[model samples]
Target: MTNPTALQLIARSNRLGADSRNTNYAGGNTSAKGSETDPVTGEPVELLWVKGSGGDLGTLTESGLAVLRLDRVRALPEVYPGVEREDEMVAAFDYCLHGKGGAAPSIDTAMHALVDAAHVDHLHPDSGIAFATAADGEQLTKDAFGGRVVWVPWRRPGFQLGLDIAAVKRDNPGAIGAILGGHGITAWGDTSEEAEANSLWIIETAAAHLAEHGHPEPFGSVIDGYEALPEDARRAKAAALAPVLRGLASTDHPVVGHFTDSDVVLDFVARAEHPRLAELGTSCPDHFLRTKVKPLVLDLPANASAEDSIARLRELHEAYRADYTAYYERGAAAARARGEEPPAMRGADPAIVLIPGVGMFSYGADKQTARVAGEFYVNAINVMRGAEAVSSYAPIDEAEKFRIEYWALEEAKLQRRPARKPLATRVALVTGAASGIGLATAKRLAAEGACVVIADLDLERAAAAAAEIGSSDVAVGVQANVTDEAAVQAAVDAALLAFGGLDLVVNNAGLSLSKSLLETTVADWDLQHNVMAKGSFLVSKAAAKVMIDQGLGGDIVYISSKNSVFAGPNNIAYSATKADQAHQVRLLAAELGEHGIKVNGINPDGVVRGSGIFAGGWGAKRAAVYGVPEEKLGEYYAQRTLLKREVLPENVANAVFVLCASDLDHTTGLHIPVDAGVAAAFLR
Candidate 1:
């Protein structure tokens, strides 16, 4: 057997799509080419060979391959208008092929041409597409690969898509492959065989996994509502669908020939099988830029009256457009916040493609692009299904998603760039620092070069913890009760007097009680509330006064817990206090935001080892009290989290550091979870 050449690998992957019973007529394309290297001079030169348009990869020949100077192709989109630009692109290819004969370039030629790697292959593998199609595509991918894959969310394909891929390449210099939402997968390697093998391997792996988990082919299932529509009604339905499809496709994607006749396209779409028609749409986020989150489903029965059907279809279309606009606006705002330019909204008229009687049509710049949209739809369906299974598939609300989508700092950090060292000259005060989150946070601040003052009720224990933190940075231990206003104020004075100024305050002193709401005494509730909730407020107030007096902005972090939101059974006082702490942080943020004093909280769940809360042989006592073995307590909490790992004090420390440091300047009033996804229970 001979090793497959780059083009052969590309062709083989394309054929595999056929074998898997995926792809429709001109539905997906494949590309394989290498960067040009000067033979005589050995200089690296721009070179790319892509599958030309109008040719299926299964039957593609060398003549079907189009060659272009990579540099020139990458620049085409900027110099021409939509249709004129595409025409000029083909013309350029023709001029390049004057001497050497090959097929006209692919519609996605620009994408392949712009990628930074020498050997690149692009395909819309079914399994890969299916995985991308899900609403939890990122989580699904993580579950499938166990944290070994790179993923890029859906974006409109064209210059923007090319740019995104190029950026990913730079970020993951050694990444095996990347799954593009709704669009497909881009696999690269030192050689074509490696790229193709990896792509095929991932697709097969994802498919087998999904099949094992009961995700069948998306189209095989019968759609309940629209299977029996009338013919005249179908045409009206298709017309109604056109705008919704058009709105989703938008104007930013590569404008191919199929996309030009949006109205006629929808007219044809109105007559197809409803399920099959919807399946024809793109399946992932990569397709979102082109196809909105979901496609329109127009049902026209052969026996139904045309007038009634038309009215029904119009109503459906209007509903779809309204939903799509809302989704787009939400997504646009998120994208903008994440530093990504929003897609141009051409008009109120959507980019929908209508299909008669059968369903509606939604198109992307290309097939893979549409597949991305389809993937999102599929994921949405899965989410709906899972929700049904568990009574509801609750996800983070729109506001939270919006925050994540628009968070510029978060997106920047995804590249794992080391955050800026911002506490070089800062001074910090940490309470309850003898052990647990407080001690960990104090040590962390000291490590970051901040002068740290560790305060605790046990002076000796605080001194011991501070000593272990080292002697280089200014670290002192003070004995004080966080709940006592005078004692807390004295500690603050001592810290400021020692360090000359204060910039960060971590109110980490707290107590937890595990008693039923009715079984708990009023004194227990007051004690827990006064220490954890009231104590945090007093410490924050003192810190803010110092910060304001110094004329320098500062940060205050309250240590909260997962119980704050979930309210674990028998933990009423603890849960309520933590919840109050979170609210207090929010109020402080609003009050001090303008003054440059940022306030935030870290909500940790199940933190073990080096934490006093869990150190008093409480796990054993609780286990005995609950009739479970002490050994199982760790497993109990760990299993509840998505990561299924113990929540270490170090993890909480890292989060506290992130919140207090300047890296979180725009992140005030936020509650960061260092709970390994436990709060996701409430989200789900």
Candidate 2:
């Protein structure tokens, strides 16, 4: 077989880059194993030539490469910091200096180093990255690549990243390369041209497959509207970021050095939004182990000094630590149950690099690793935006993520076991807990050993319901208008402060307004939306914040209605909101699944008795309309089901309990019916 020339290799790289562009962003990076020297000589050698940072593969020139002694590069992490810096970068350049001195190395050098193949190439092909960034990235990878490729969970690139890659290669001896979910692809070949060709092939395959499936362009850029900051503003931002970065990292293992005094860096930080800047960390889960998942936003008041910015950053850092500690604890319990050793404090501090004008640095083990992490984050933001375009981007509750992050094995173990007490020692917040399904679910969860927080608009009734449960696991009732963000957030804060964390949230607070589609008034529609749809969204958001911080995968159950699917007469408002509830569950399930959260909805048909709606004039009116005695209404509703049995509040509660407990580990984005088989045909 004829060896490919440089031009051929460049053409293949360009094709891969073109394939990547359809997904958004420039095509990803690529690298190849170059000629190696004799080890006996003890001289400089070139083992790999990896893509340099900020260079698109399609347009890459000979200079857009960085040759490093692969074995030496891998060994650098073991050396002390001082020695590694002086010895590695300079020694690696002795054999070949492909780029300018200041050029950043490709973020995926670690992965390439571990492959140890003759050639390696990695890229964030548009379709692949978009698919990888999805909640079901692993599953999607399986569907696309089948069982041939090695799939690595999202991890920050660096020493650990290399280790993970090595582990994969060791485990899967014949694996061609590894796929990093929520990030991109890694391919290896016997030669540089083969590596480049493999990458192009992978991209072409993914793009073609996704195109056939009608993949939407990953939500296009939304950052164009942000106005650039002024020079004065930029200076102030840099000055402010310097101290904050120092303070946050001063006591930690590594500290910032490169951009601390750079005006260019400061200008970039000042121009960036605080929230956006703080969020620039890696989007992948493994990145968190290297760089704590979130960054601290240092927002100084107008005319505030550097001291103020430092203080603010310190406060935020402390807050992040406190939240992480709490999350670790919650996740620890799950870990213990799974027979896994709890995470030791590895001195892994938050990845809060100072970006100066762009905001702050999203520090990882190194610049390349940080860049990859940032890419993951950017992908997540894009996914959120895209999902928002389709519908609301509701993520799974934080508690669920925490649980997954900490004790996914435990969750699995718990699932394997028979149902234990409904929610042993778990803390739950149940909205609309005063009546109907909410009250019954609260009682059931409390019976199962959960400390239930009953929140309802009716304080008196919520308290009464709490009293009825009478479990030591029950807490004082909290009156809350679920639609009110502050009120819901307060409830979440109280639960976290009081119980130290939360395990479940049942968003059952909702109202039904029956009206024909044409007759539905705007006020009536808004009222139903506010109470049912908006309330669930707000409460879930508040609960998820705590759960994610706690690192415990918590369950969130939205109380949808059968009308979500089978819309009925004079129930336009209720039906629409119910449909929204179902969609909300799916969105949350997708967004929060990686965090180990499982979101599901319950659609109870004709829940009889216990509901306030059935205890008043509305019940009598409904009974008369259906030609049944008011007292017989419950039975009549129950008989409407295929099972010819009434759907009681307890039945709804049981379904809710199943979700809140560990019984449904592999389940999410699902709708369980407690309506006695009314919707039997739709059953999976």
Candidate 3:
């Protein structure tokens, strides 16, 4: 009969995956076994279904489970006493799967299969790892669980680990779970309920033991738990530190940086004892694979100036990288001593960075990955706090760490992720990105893997829009009134600081006025000119300076309206300013061409849906202009176009994206239209 426990296992596994307090994205694995008849032969067979490699447990489905024939998997000669070839061991694993659809079984499957339980869970709970990595962890677990759990020293994941765990299980037949020193924990039972409960029991017992001994919070505030400081003295100091650190921590290619000063991070980094203790290494083996061991910690001085801070971050970055090279040598030597040829290691760049006076930072190729690194490090800090409170904190020895750091399997997990999108390493800034074409463009660029800065006058709305983009690392919302030089400069700084440099600048901020010339006062004309014409110039000017400094040919796109080219009756002020803006693009293209910069203009017509202008009564005003009801404005405009189609914000955004396409290296000083075949507005 097929397993009746699959539902319960799925439920419990998802619960564990969903809670960051338990594990972060794809950090743990789960499995369940059952007996069933083979589909092809109708013969009774035992099956093992475990979480697939690279599959997210939080949203795991039956399709994500790798179905394997249990008898075949357990009998593989790769696990036999005489077999030691990791390649052969890997090949053996691939040979046992029952189907070809799901992802490859997780590297932990062999260990899970050997547990001799219907249900098994392997979790990287921070609380459990605290006791596991404690200086006296071996005995601490023993004392807390009173032999209810077994202790297994760290070993690289493979057939050998399965054998070691099996041996431990054999020795302690009464124990429900075991701790893998320097790694995570494994628990098993007849059902997922029993297995999860026992796992929670082990975690709680270890966590409680530490608390009972002395529940001490790590040092965060300047003055105990009462009134104290949060990181550096001023908010501006903390704000200024992000970009400088981002520039330093980034690698040769591209890695986005994320900063967090949440209370947890501050407490962990602000501790007087952290500098020495933090260097000990990762909370678990999975961490060693994801974030590497240790982090690049920056020491912020009292009342540091901007120049001093920048210089300090740069100096510290150099030292951090140089120290990594030396550490890599020691690790490589240790690996060679094990009689195994060490793989050529990459530069020892710490994935996590802790700043004593601010908070913490994590780097990854993309935003989601950076957040994962941040979450894992935060978990580590909390666990380390608990472990140190109980006794001295300790992690696995250097020899074992060397094995994990160089593990072919652990490295494969990173390399196996999907290929990056075309705009993978680029950073883009979209002004007026709170809604309409700007918002659409921001989403498009972010989806293409570019770090996006959403600049708008309304920061609260812009931030909400950015959050909807769903990757905080790539999407940042900054408040900017483009007419104000300082606000414009600050927005530019936010982009450059967060992403190391800026590449694309979209000058899309604008306002529309439809008053007749006779009724239009000097005030209305100035308001339209100041925002549409002057704002574009100001934002563009600031952006070019940064691009010139980087010496990287970048793109600057101006989103001028269709009125720029076609004279609409009541749009004199808007059209006149737009014409000036469109001419500005050609002028910029001429001037910036020498610096390898490309400048272009996009004129969007009839984009009503999701357009901020239309939402602000522009639709009703335009409908009145056309002598039609307000609700039919979209239809009215669509019918007026040759293509008989509605021009949506996405249509405008697509035109902007085309203008920004990488292949158009020589195609600057152009105006692309998106108005469903508005022949008059078309670029000739």
User: Which candidate wins on TM-score?
Assistant: 3
The TM-scores, one per candidate, come to 0.39, 0.41, 0.87
Cα-lDDT of candidate 1: 0.60
Candidate 2 CA-lDDT value: 0.61
Ranking by TM-score: 3, 2, 1
Q: Candidates 2 and 3: which is better by lDDT?
A: 3
lDDT of candidates 1 onward, in order: 0.60, 0.61, 0.77
* Model 3 C-alpha lDDT per residue in residues 226-327, reported as the tens digit of each score: 221443353345556655555455554456666666787766665666777778877587676667778877666435565676677778778888877777
Query: How many pairs of residues collide in each model?
Result: 54, 35, 1
Candidate 3: pairs in clash = 243-497
* Total clashes in model 1, counting residue pairs 3 or more apart in sequence or in different chains: 54
lDDT of each residue in 1-684, candidate 1, tens digit only: 211343564566466445533333343455555445555678765556666765665666666667665556666656645631332454554544322536666446656666665566666555666555455667767777753457878754444566677777778766666777655677666566666566677767766676667523332333334343454444343333332233233333321112222232333333323334343343332232244433555454433454565566557766765775676587787667756665444333233333333333334333333333333343334423322222222233344343333333223323353452456656688989889888878888877767788999999997888788875235878897988998997787666434445678898997766788898899989999999898998999888876775456789998888777885667788889988998998899999988788998888886767778777665665566556677677667788788888887878889988887656678898888887778553422
For all the candidates, what are their Cα RMSDs to the real structure? 26.6, 25.6, 4.0
* Residue 430 accuracy (lDDT) in model 2: 91
Model 2 lDDT per residue over 1-684, tens place = 211333444555666665424222344566666544445686645556666655667676656666565666666556524421332333343333422322446445666666667666666554445455556666656776776566787654444556677687778776666667656677778876667666666666665656665425333332332223455564445533533353344344432211222333333334423345335333433333334555555554334555565566667777777766775676667657756565454343455454333333444332233344444444444444332333333333344345334433323333454464546546689998888888888888877767788888988987888788873235547889987998887676555433335668998987765456797899989999999899999988877765564455679999898888875667788888999999999999999988777899998886658887667455775676678998998888777778889888899888888877666878999998777777642444
Number of the top lDDT candidate: 3
